[model samples]
Target: MRMLRYCSLLALVAALAACSSVPGGGPVSQTKGEYKVGNPYKVAGKVYVPKADPHYVAEGMASWYGPKFHGRKTANGETFNMNALTAAHTTLPMPSYVRVTNLENGRNLILKVNDRGPFVGDRLIDVSRRSAQLLGFEKQGVTRVRVEAVPGPNARPATVFARNTPAPATSPVEQKKAPIVVASARPAPVFTPEPAKKDEVVVQPLEAEPDSPATASENIYVQIGAFSDKLRAKMVADDIRHVGQTLLELVDINGQKLYRVRIGPLPSKARADETLGRALAWGHNTARIVLD
Candidate 1:
């Protein structure tokens, strides 16, 4: 009888160890707890943790997904539609909804966080192709934006299958929420181009023709205008400076001493134009496009 009891105890211990040894294994109940999907997911080099009440409000660079993942399975097993007003988040529940705003242009977009990533630096979320376009990132390719969780019913299925089925389009009223209008129909503009003139054509005397047109990371810079109050300038700067890349500089443009905010080392004029457009959508009409 003593031997039988010892054997039973040993068997129980082995079973417990096996259960814990399973990858991403955790407590298992018939009705799982919040985010019972599995342990955190490891992809590329980053680990993504799912949260039940993962309400995140962050400011960072916003990018978009396109042909690369049009019909691929999202983190929640849903079919990713680049055109949908959906987004990818690292931790928010599979079907959680979010509101992304371009503080610079006052553009806002509501998106469903059914996927994961932007995983490049301090970026918080990656919006869908349509969402990014609506947020004015289609042309610029990337922009600084704010993301906030919005309350919603969690009844929506977490995954979508890309059959011939199509999701309903966002209504005009819904689109209005996005202050910046990006053209989704057009492909991303080509940034690289041949030099305009092979040899230096001096339009101005001794004006050192810029050594090769500015590359996207070298030439384009932004200048923010001043407000009647210093507080306002700081407020706008705080909103626009989502990425550490953007810097606030105090300078005079056209004899007006203003609190100038600038970003980049953008390489070319085309890139500068694209970035300027995004700044406009962010509501910085006075923001200047400069080459430095």
Candidate 2:
């Protein structure tokens, strides 16, 4: 993490002054490619408990790392390849697959998360230079993106077919109590890791994605919760709806009107994170900050 921060500062200076080489620039390091799910750690005062959260998904600003740390060792012991479709993340296990969508140009791709970081205030995954190019955000320095975990190689049927990020997270405890209403398109029950194979962790090489782009997205909206019932959505909206422009938006999906409690357009990623964390404290664990 310290190395990441040092490289970041150098990268900034290089960009501002257009210098070819900067003295005391971070050293180009080697990659460590091993598979690992490290212990919970702190970066810049934020605690990130690394776990194989199969349901992990997030949306926030994304930045790229290249050149200076081009050959550095990643968290998993893999050699960092700035040209490869690789990425660094905060909490995802090393060598995992994740689908990252660039909200700016609507370009998306599957990247291998093999390191930890972009550790810069609420920024999500830190893509390699090649990934940023493929996702159409290389020249921009940063862009809003949505990233969701994907099944790694040799994954079981349950893992491969698990619900995507859009689905809400409802545990059995919440289901029996029914304290919160859910969308009609309810996803399969929350995926609990099998107790027998709990320690299993696997990964595979990623195939390069095609250069297909969708329509571009705009603005940042922190969606706190979604529900088929307007009243239930409103109840959540009233509970943790303090920051930004908190409102209950009605969005139509598959012939149904789902009430979405959201706060946006957030001015920056830090603001979005604040809104998201507040919502989580109110029990909206599925709250996500998105660009759309």
Candidate 3:
């Protein structure tokens, strides 16, 4: 009877403690985070400056983190929860919100940004595992996505749909939906005669016409962009050739032709990462690695 009473008393004390802290069981975080625009920092040879931009938007690959990152400290000072609808971005201010739309599946969701990451490749964002599932790309691991900032840090999720995605050719052009300002990472000077600055590197434009590429080769390539227009593809290839060996190729997708600008056949994944960082820092938002 003494042991039973002691157990009951412990339970009662725990309930009272919870009530005192939360007041009617209100929602709260164990480690609350805050809104912050962090300083410029370098990772893997890439420098990123975090700042508040209401017009931030870009198109790129989106990956997810769960088991490895769960219960960690987020950049915003909050405890990371893989089950929560949170994300990590390269340059966006912490504790901000964005609408992430999977370009392949048309899965759109408004998620909170609370950490800094995805320092891997040219990936644009690292979403929580739950966000991946809700966005309908958890099974595939990664998906092409268009992410745009939305106002109101307290914004709630709305209007989710994942099966209505468009074709690859049309999705790139769909980036014209407007109200987007690229991150602070401005494009590098490609054709400048002046010496490269201490903080900036000059990329060279492609001077010669690249032949049709071997897309099925076992080599690796960094896809700079895909365009429905051949001229735009060639222009992008010329514009960002200094990123690496540039290649411009056209291929038919379901009877539709897409001009793909890429930097290719890198010697190793480490070189690929450096190239990706350079591409991202140079403001190529859609850049990502792919097998040739």
Candidate 4:
């Protein structure tokens, strides 16, 4: 009986050691400074407010970071592992749970938002390399995606959108070719507006040309603005319309209404590039190209 008890204790010790060898194993201890609701901070001239509420949703471009950021201390005081399912956001509270869906493909993933970054433009989130791989966008550095925060206890369920279906296969003959350089017969007008002053809207009128006919083929758009107020979005759309045709879309994000202003169903990438350049010259620097 004594021998048997000694063997059992040895087996227990071996099992505990094995468990400790696993990643994220060993004695579970709260990370120092984790789960903090940070105060508003500024990055690249934009202010970001970090609050603790879990009901948040947004849609925009998502890019992934790997080697350069791997093993670094994240915003939540935890080490960032590129292989782990983690992400970064500009405003959401650190250590929050989010559901990210790739709009191009129907892939979806759940990630822990532990860092803060991708603060260049209008990008919504920056995911880890593994998250991007699982979402089927690893090859492409960036892709369009929708992100929704997972609610905590007693919070309402997030609004889910139907997944986009794959487009029908096209024959080789019908396949669209890559955009070629097309010299404009007339010099595209260069509209340079003064830098916007605080609390002031920059509006410079361009020569109003005839609106282009809507195309049935798949086209791209450059999204310029998203606002909770419909009137505000319309006003921005009107400003953009001074340059070219515009489209307004109402999107529901986390049970909140958002009005999005977009320009064009541009026929080709070259045209899209030209339009984007013109918009940037006009001081609409946040405009991003989107597929329609």
Top-lDDT structure, candidate number: 3
> Per-residue CA lDDT of candidate 4, range 187-266, in tens?
21244444433333323232222234335654577667556666777666765664457777665444444566777767
Please, what are the lDDT tens digits per residue for candidate 2 over residues 1-292? 9999999999999787865343223222224355667899997888999888778888999999999988877887777878766789988877777777777755556667888997887798899996786566788899998887766421211111112223235532233221223324322212222222221211112222212231234456666655667666667666654434576666554444466666766666555544553343333434555554
Better of 1 and 2 by TM-score: 2
Span of ten consecutive residues with least summed lDDT in model 2: 154-163
Candidate 4 Cα lDDT to native: 0.63
lDDT of 1 by residue, 91-190 (tens): 7766666667765565665566777776787777888876675565688878877777765422222111111223226522233221211111222112
Alpha carbon lDDT of residue 103, candidate 4? 88
Compose the digit string of candidate 3's lDDT tens values, residues 1-292.
9999999999999988877874323223324776567799999999998877888889999999999988989987899988666899988877777888888866566677889989988999999996786566899999999998877433333333435422233422343322211222223223333332232222233232223342343556666765666666666676567546777666443444455567866666556655654454344534666553
Clashing residue pairs found in predicted model 4? none
> Candidate 1: TM-score?
0.40
RMSD of each: 22.5, 20.9, 20.6, 20.8
> Candidate 3, 292: how far from true, in Å?
50
* Model 2 regions lying over 4 Å from their true place: 1-32, 153-292
Please give the CA lDDT of all the candidate structures. 0.54, 0.61, 0.65, 0.63
Off by over 4 Å in 1: 1-38, 153-292
Candidate 2 residue 222 C-alpha distance from true site, Å: 38
